[model samples]
Target: MNKQQTETMQNTLAQNKNLLQNEQTLVNKQVGLNINKNSENLDDLLEFVKKETQTFKDISARGSSYVSIVKSENGTRFVINKATNEKLGYPTEIYIGYKDEHLMIFNAEGMAVNKLTVRQTKNKITIYNTKLVDEIINHFGIDFSEITSKSFAEGYFENKGREILYVKLL
Candidate 1:
């Protein structure tokens, strides 16, 4: 090709490359929007599942207590580990929490209490084996109620003259 024509062609190719890059950026942004939507939906489902549920823990770890809470308006900028001044869940605004490994379930007001267990008014479901119940409920990728209890091994033992229940989660 002539030198002038070659220069013109190179310029055209460079412009096309720039155009392609811009198009790719736009596509990436579109994908980001879709991802945000799906993440919100997943968070909604997680909230529904965890609502009004109680967790039980054996606190031999000498850890403190923690409570994670989501605010009403924003889905990002959550206050995680507030007692430790640690802020997390910033982008989605979901509530995250950390305790000092003391092993306990908490209520909305943040106490070592299970607000929903029928048999555990004493803050421990050691007798009725709610550990197994919670483990079964937390299983992923299947209908929790449909899973046979034999899928997991449930165990029992005595602790300080009290029955302690144990289960292998997942």
Candidate 2:
């Protein structure tokens, strides 16, 4: 192998490692976060983030870092209105991917309306709101009791040494 190629591979691997580490850290923090809509003002919560946490960045098609902005709200902290970004009649959902690659679908306030996951295919990268997906799947099997219908559909399953809450249906 050429030296240049070797160096390139090493650099790629290092970046991947950093991304994984940063993502894991963010996940740990997310577990401790109060993600209730109609709760608090996002501006103040973001201020807390600025004071108590350090932001990490990455280079990816999805995003390099999260862009936190004050939504068009007066003073409420929890705003999860998907229709806020309506152009004509489209209720386009705007989500924010956090430092740990955890996708949060908010309604406009800082409150977390839903969660998303990042997945990779052979030639494509996709993201989806997991909570919505779960809701659909659950509705289809409404007759079944909680977590007893499907083995793979168990929201509380321990997968990959972590508790997976939902899956992105893409």
Candidate 3:
């Protein structure tokens, strides 16, 4: 072959090789993205299954001392029913204050005489004083399982119609 023709053929081959490598890289990247997308879809499906299968907790207390324990795919929380605006019979804002590792419960009027607190772990809920828990359960008619069967546990008291306060014992 002529020298010029040989050089031209070499350049064409090199360009083809470069193009093929670039295409391969793109294909590999697309494969990786597909795998990640599949895993993300699987994660979403798993969460949906968990939420559908799990049962939320509902506990009723007596004399404006109702509590609802709720859990979802996201997390768990305790709700005080009587603290709602409907139960309050007026518009009020709940205030929270921290004192000696206990949460001071208050409303628009003033601080409550009986301070309530809760200690929750991954599987258990413990009130600062068992007596308070018992009083709520006995006098106020609060009903809750001694041990939670779910992945997370929570307990709280209602401050206002929409204000649920939690105590920090940790």
lDDT of every model, 2 decimals: 0.33, 0.36, 0.42
Q: Per-residue lDDT of 1-170 in model 1, one digit per residue for the tens?
A: 99999999999999999999788779756644223433524444335434843345443222232322221222211111322222211111111122231122222222243333222222321213344334424432224344332222221222322222222222
lDDT of prediction 3: 0.42
Ranking by lDDT: 3, 2, 1
Question: In each prediction, how many residue pairs overlap at the backbone (N, C-alpha, C within less than 3 A)?
Answer: 6, 7, 4
- 113 Cα displacement, candidate 2 (Å): 54
Structural similarity to truth (TM-score) of each candidate: 0.20, 0.21, 0.21
lDDT of 2: 0.36
TM-score, predicted candidate 3 vs. hidden true structure: 0.21
User: Over the stretch 118-151, how does candidate 2's per-residue lDDT look in tens digits?
Assistant: 3333322223444543454444433333332121
Ranking by TM-score: 3, 2, 1
Q: Which pairs of residues clash in candidate 1, taking residues 3 or more apart in a chain or in different chains?
A: 63-100, 64-100, 75-92, 75-93, 76-92, 76-93
lDDT of 3 by residue, 41-101 (tens): 4444435444644433433224333333333343345443444323433223334344443
TM-score of 1: 0.20
Better of 2 and 3 by lDDT: 3
